[model samples]
Target: MTNVVTCFLRHRTAVLLGRRSDAVGTYTGRWAGISGYVEGDPADAERDARREVREETGRTDATLVRAGDPVDIEDDGREWTVHPFLFEVDSREVTPNEEIAVHEWVSPPAIRERETVPGLWAVYAAVAPTVETVASDDTHGAAWISVRALEVLRDRAAVADDEAAVASVARALRDARPSMAAVANRVNRVMSGGDRTPGTVRDRAAAAAEAALDADDAAAATAAERCGVSVVTLSQSGTVRAALDRARPAVLIGESRPAREGTDVAASLADAELDVTLTTEAALPAELAARAPDSVLVGADAVLADGSVVNKVGTRGLALAAAREDVPVYVVAAAAKVRPDEAVHGETGDTAALYDGAAPVSVANPIFDRTPADLVTGVVTERGVLDTEGIRAVAAEHRERAEWDGGLEGAGTVSG
Candidate 1:
């Protein structure tokens, strides 16, 4: 069987699609991913995939998200096996080679509407996050996981017209990150709040992803307005990053441990023209006493019913430090982050991530901690600073939407 690699280059919410030129050997004038024949070791398909992206799109920096298993297809008197790769790029700019006549970045689900080679959607299915991937992901925040959840719905919608897949994917996504209000809240919104057959859910999922991104950006803008000139923060939250980029305040940050995400956060703000100080997660009291900031700003994994914030493990200490220093604490998060749940789910990190040494010390690496609402001065969202009552009102609305059953029950796996 002949081997080839199809690389899907993705930006923020959309993916790159190109129309093949007449000069191309096969499927000329049809839309396809950046692709080329795998001329070397099949195991080097990833190397070949990146090379192909560089050749076709002139993007040498495309980061691979996942590589899918080979898909066999019989087409045009040839036996073909296609290798799939998905990549994320920071910029949307591309300079296509002779292979493509025109290129456009479109939602992955929109591929369903395009005329293309056989198994195009199937190729995407391999590289994209499955229900299992979304369920087991422990490295990202709620907002990021929520987008991947919508992407799961998007891919399922692209593959079939089965409403069962929609409900199944939605239910799976809600449970994937139980502590994440955004994942469940947003998925439930699409499943119940929208016209959600498989065909329709694709567009709705795409639109909802866009809305979530916008809400985060708007929420960041609101928080930026409230940020004091001196701020103490932790963790690498996209919403926090956006707000800090806007505020450019003096920052005293702690390493959000088990992962030194705070270092990355500081590096990300290198161009923001802000003064920064980085300390260990355990040095909260010393750091706060040494450099008392005006506010302790953080991003939430989930905002509980009473406005309590669930965030990185170091956040409770940070908030307590801020309180002792008589500084106010502000939480920046999208409105969807407010969940109906009153109790925070404890998620422990991998023991290997904490300690793999021969010592018999048991490691309990709780990934997050809750900061009481009484200690929080304000909860900033896209709607501006919400009072305790405002936060509770939003949580109640989500509680109403929490029930996964809109009307369809017994939405098991898709069966023929």
Candidate 2:
């Protein structure tokens, strides 16, 4: 029924609270922080907080440390939407108006000993965890970030189910690792789910991110079904490995040099009971000609608008060789790998990794390379088999305006 801004002015280890005076309209004789009814838009909550602090405590130099996610509290029949904030004050001196009888700086542990207003403790309890998780450095991969992001959103939804807050959280997560299309896809789907309450947004985001793994598995199965009896692959890709595991086809893995990612792939395939043969980059042509695999399957870090794929190094060369051999080349990847633009390839790898025995001889070892669209027979994805046209359609459908503008800014990592 009313919007209020509640601010906690904090020192090193304690916070300031006011004992309500009989002159105040509500919560008389109860302990609370500096709070007042929001007079205008919720966006003005910060300004309102500053004004409340100056008016109640006569402190004009409090620095805002954190603006927490808002919490909704039910008082009698009216609903009080409380926008919580934490401010650091240099001085603890207080000059209370008629709204307060006394001001006390209380330590966190001792706050409960004093009789506080309803849902006062719940305010910090609701917002702190979500804020902490969002600002934490523990989040790394797509799956880890997805789970952590959803946790923050769920907590945020419990307090304020506002679009602005949800969108803010989504953008932060999406920008966490721009190279990860799964993050963007999950967040975009949730944001585009129409104007719903915060709870709905949080729920949809959680479900989308949680189901991403299963969706990837389903896509891998489809890719494997499309492959032939003997498949030649370069580099290591989780999607490709999944597909190969499901298909159980005899594999010819090129020893992706500089990094030798293919060794890992070969080992995984061998462990899965699939016949595996590992060949060096220099000997790939001879190996391909000798083995004569029916198909070349690889995984894409990004599938561009032109339907070309960007993957680990040596993919372009392998595809060219496969094309010359008249073998079908398939990219086993999830739909999230599709991008609106060509990926920004990073600098070459550490040349020292190529040959420790060389000094004057220069080495060029890039991490990834582009394989032309013409070389690719089709892209196998969770959405089923997709040709160049199909990939283009996917880009048109899911690629947001922001992606088209710059293509996931600061995506420098070479991941597949």
Candidate 3:
């Protein structure tokens, strides 16, 4: 199979190249992008890209920008698909990875003169304009301008016109708001319910439902139409699961382990005629990786104050792998997933014990695992896709709101 290469170029320059190792391959000793094979596991791609980048440049702090489509190339009878990505880093800090015999930052004109690998040049040409636009915008004293550049590339590649694209972006933004809000409300309800507060389970469920439906039918329909892929959710939390279901993606439920709560989700989703995949946790990563899914939708058991997330143990590996691969990973839990008290206590737990009755064997199980905020591309709540800072702000807001409402009286507390 042709490997997928993440072509990392200098932010505004032509492309970054690295000398290949002595191993046999196309363009050996010639410069190449940060490349790797597309693994059956979605996490492999992301991991490979990061590894390659570090390997090629010896920099750990590089922030990668998602570039456009994959470009196909063939060398010595072996074909490869190159996925272009851009990153801006302090050039002074670059150190060549051991595999790299040499490195150079070549300009577009210089790129033309080199015995550049075939297919790669075209890919670079396609993405060069976008990178240049971003660079120019940055030089002109513009506010953070990466997204606008991405918008440009997205527009150029789009088959639809401006209006369609705008509408699509609008609908996604619109749907995300209420979905996140529903998540927040559900969490609040659960916390409140545990304390025997005024709200009942039905009330919380209703609040969640309302958040899911806040957008008009037309907007919701548009979003569903625009999103190209189906997302199966594996969560036991009702409010969260329901919120995800109402988002209109084709969702399937895996029988959640231990309690087998996923059975309930599967039955419900099946009744709705949604294509459901019922499987155990061990099978989830392989299943998802095999499908080469667009994204993975799951909930968090807890999110630390520092923005690290704690979800089910199985979820951590799945998420890390997904993040490693180029696939976008989203944690669709509500603001309630944020554990306000985690700061006072360090966050660490045994996750192996969630399974039933193997008491004779020592099983250390903690209900959650920490997922660094960076690993998460976005947090989809009834509110929307919140960045790391946005998530922190929202979590703080919820804490304040809960305290003001006397909503924290009897809640269980755990320190991070």
Candidate 4:
């Protein structure tokens, strides 16, 4: 049996694909990812994958995101096994070696159209997100999940006939993460729009994905205006990191418990040259009182019509601490995060995450919590600082988007 490794280098929404040269390859002129034979112990498959990426692309700065189980396939009567790995490369620049005759970065789904090596799409599928993977992801933020939701909608839109299957996908995405209102809102905007044909749904989903990404950047920019000289925050929001990058504030971060996501965020911010202080969730109140930062800038998973914010479990406590210290708390998120009502169903994590020991005591680990509106000083969005009234107004607009609900009222309008 032949053993090989396939590496997929992704930059943002696109993945790198190389066209094979005519010199020495069996699949000459065929589109493929960076791949090579796997040698040594099977556990060293990732090591070999990275080596191939470095050798083929002439770059050594790729970071591994995920790896898939080895896949078995038969190509032209040759039995083989493929180990797949996905990496995130910061830059699109690739100095292709002789193995690749030409290289181009493109959206992942576009790879299916070209004539390629056997099982290339299947290999790619092993490492990419499916509707199930997107629904189950717990480490990413709401904005990130929302964009992925749009991706799920777009990728699955054209896979069926009645397009009712696509509508079901949209609903599944909407309910995937109950705490992530941004995902539901973005999907609602795309599905509620006129025309529900597969083509229209796919195009609309693509457009919504772009707009959601842009809205995140714009919201970050708006939040940067109020970031102040000193700020305290918790959890890990890509938008919050972007805002911090723009302002360069002296930051204090609390390690969001269970997952301790803020510890990772602190390292990233510090790497970006920002002065950062890391603290524990239990000691955050003391740190806030002693340091007295100018603002508590946090990110939101959802903003309710009454102006309350839903975020990571520690966020409410952070806001409460900030309130007591006379520090203003600013919630930064896109306006689309605001929902018409406070329909909440927060997910709980594995009890093993909190207590995996042989203790008689029980453990509860809720993944999120809602912070009261009164505790938040203001909500900053892509549009600007929104007052309570402004938030409610946006909610009212979202309320009108219920035209597509229940039994697929607009399911018939799907794209062809």
Candidate 5:
């Protein structure tokens, strides 16, 4: 059995296909989605799909929409298992490598008219739902997703209120993205509302979720009020953006590597017509030394009971640097981001995101890191700026309530 990966790089409504060159092995001169053999780990096949697309097409901005289950096909007595992937790209510009003579972006329906590799269209059909899921996720951040999840529960409540059904939805939302503390806290809030009447429960949960967003805005505004002329931040955060919008200070952003979310942040601020300086992550300290911004502001993925802020991978470094420079580091987030329990720093994705397999290499791509409470000047929440004591009190209250609501029996523990 031979394992291979086939990637469908999509731009808007069209899918890109390359006409295989005569110099390439088998299926020469035939049209196919970017294809390659699975290397190293089978689990890394999706990563391989992305790498192949980059190598073959020179497009680095494609977002992986979905990776469907592999489909097996018999061709010339050899069994080929094709791993299919769908990526949404912004541009349609194609720069072909030696393996591909030329490329074309064709509509889905028109794909059948062209002479192509077998089962090419079938692969797309299998993964259509996956693309739809990516497209449908309106909330790009954990905070937004948490609110949306609560909204879903409220809608489900209007129908029939079953404990199993509610739990099922809660579990799916919680498990959908485990590392987001806001997701856990928000879901726990709704689940804690108990299996009361679906309407009451739904109303309470929906209200709570909406309140969280409002608090987020308030917290960001409060944090922004304390900032100086310029601020340096890493990663792309809705809370940070909100604060920046309010503060309207000169901003320096690190083009966060791997994901490059900071680039998004920079573009957004630039569009707002704010004075923004975009730089590489490595150059942050030099920028800090030269500019000396009033404060380093960031958003939290989870605000732990000890008051430590868990955020994007580079956040800890930014906080530490701010400490040395005597610049206060503030985390702006809604109270919903606070978790009663210890933070969970989830594992990141494949190493292929960092390197091509041309040479033997090992890569560590952790998505989040925790900044010690001591380094944090303050945690700006909807309730107000929380010192360590204030944070502990808030966390204790939440835990006590969660214990009662989550059916933890006598388990009501909060560590300061």
Candidate 6:
């Protein structure tokens, strides 16, 4: 029997299972999702999730919705840990495989009662939802909902008055117009696509913030004026650039190597009237340690649930330096940047370019580094300033409503 790994796959209404072929060995008749080991790849978790869906069910059109924590199990005296990934597939396309002798499309409770494998059972429980299924199909649809509409519905449901539902609908209608406008503008920017290199993501983000202000000048100006300095080890986002213009705080921009995104940040800050200082990546620690600014803000490419931050190569060191100096480091991020998919990826950049072709250069230029939760004092959102715990709370709230209201549709509702 070949050594085989097993995973239980689930969709909105049913769990997938497979009966192993006799030649495959262990648990020849046992049902399971597609599972295999790919050695030496750190992206195993993502790869496994995709592979399982395609191999077992012939559903290659699914995207990973989330990756849960790992579960350890022992079978036949061998111990293995399975990393479960929650995926949304078209329920309509599900068909039993030849290896799957008999399949069941049971509700969550029924699956819990019948699943035989301990590891697969645990994964099912973790991903199961309590709410009734709203829609089901052979293929899973994209999880898209306007943030504003969801908020209005939730708010109405929370109230205890006859007018609650009416208020909610009214508010949703009022907000939806602007929300759609914002999305349209962003879509236009992408469609027009002029100089949209990788560097332009930041530029686009900043431009969006600036454009948001046209609807309400006072609020936009206020957001633009919030006092916070981004001690960026790389380039600042268009959003951050707009904020700096209004806030006008001193910036400590670091010359992050190869990319030199910091040069871009410094130049932008200078253009915005913020007192800008350029320094080497290594100098960030000393510069922040020397004095306390109103706050040290940085942009994140991605963020983990435990509040670890992933940014440019030198971010972790800079965050550490800030922590030691009693300085608060705030991470500026959009909801889209929050990656609850898997363990934070720490690798950031090409090592060769990071070292500038130096001899004996074995440099690690992770495009994103992890900033532990303790070091991050707060998060600045279009909504407002949130401390570490507060950020988690807000995120939790978002997660709870993610399915029904959609993720961060009323994100602008929190805007200054």
- Each candidate: RMSD to true structure? 4.9, 16.9, 22.0, 4.7, 12.0, 19.2
- In angstroms, give how far residue 79 of model 6 lies from its true place: 69
lDDT of 4 at 7: 91
Clashes of each: 0, 0, 26, 8, 0, 25
- My TM-score estimates for the predictions, one after another, are 0.89, 0.56, 0.41, 0.91, 0.64, 0.41
Instruction: Pick out the ten consecutive residues of candidate 1 with the lowest summed lDDT.
Output: 407-416
All candidates' lDDT scores? 0.83, 0.71, 0.51, 0.85, 0.75, 0.49
Residues 1-416, model 1: lDDT tens digits: 98999999989788899999988888888899998899999888998898889999999888788888998988778887999999999889999998899999998877778998767877877888878888887556778778889888877777655888677778878777777779888887787664667878887888888899889989999998877788888887889888888888998888788777888787767646679888888886678878777777899988888878888888888788888889889999998999776667777778898789998989878888888888899989998899889988998877777654752223222100
Best by lDDT: 4
Model 1 / residue 307 / CA error / Å: 1.2
Q: Write the number of the candidate with greater TM-score, choosing between 2 and 5.
A: 5
lDDT preference between candidates 1 and 2, better one: 1
In TM-score terms, candidate 1 sits at 0.89
Best by TM-score: 4
RMSD (Cα, Å) of candidate 3? 22.0
The ten-residue window of minimal lDDT in model 5 covers 407-416
**Ranking of all candidate structures by their lDDT, best first:** 4, 1, 5, 2, 3, 6
lDDT by residue (1-416, candidate 6, tens digit) is 12223444544334465555564445666555566554435346677566656766778777565466666778788777666666666454665455566565543333334435546666554443211111121011011212212222322222324433433443343233321222222223322334333224223423433333332233224344445554433444444554566667777778776567678768766776777989888787888777566666666645555676666568788888877777766666544334332244333356656566647867765454567777876555555555556556644543443333233343322110
How many Å off is the CA of 56 in candidate 2? 56
- Candidate 4: 10-residue stretch with minimal lDDT: 407-416
Tens-place lDDT per residue, model 3, 1-416, is 56575656463322477667666354676656666556555445656677767766777777665566667777788877776666666454577656666677654334445665666556665555443454333111011232233233333323234433433432332222121222232334333334322223223333333333332222223223323366645645434444444654565445655556677777767776666677777777667666666666666555555666665446666676666666676665455445443432222233454545656666554434456777776665545556667767866765654442353333233432
Q: What's the true lDDT of residue 43 in model 2?
A: 81
**Residues 55-96 of candidate 4: C-alpha lDDT, one tens digit per residue:** 999879898878998888798899779999999887898999
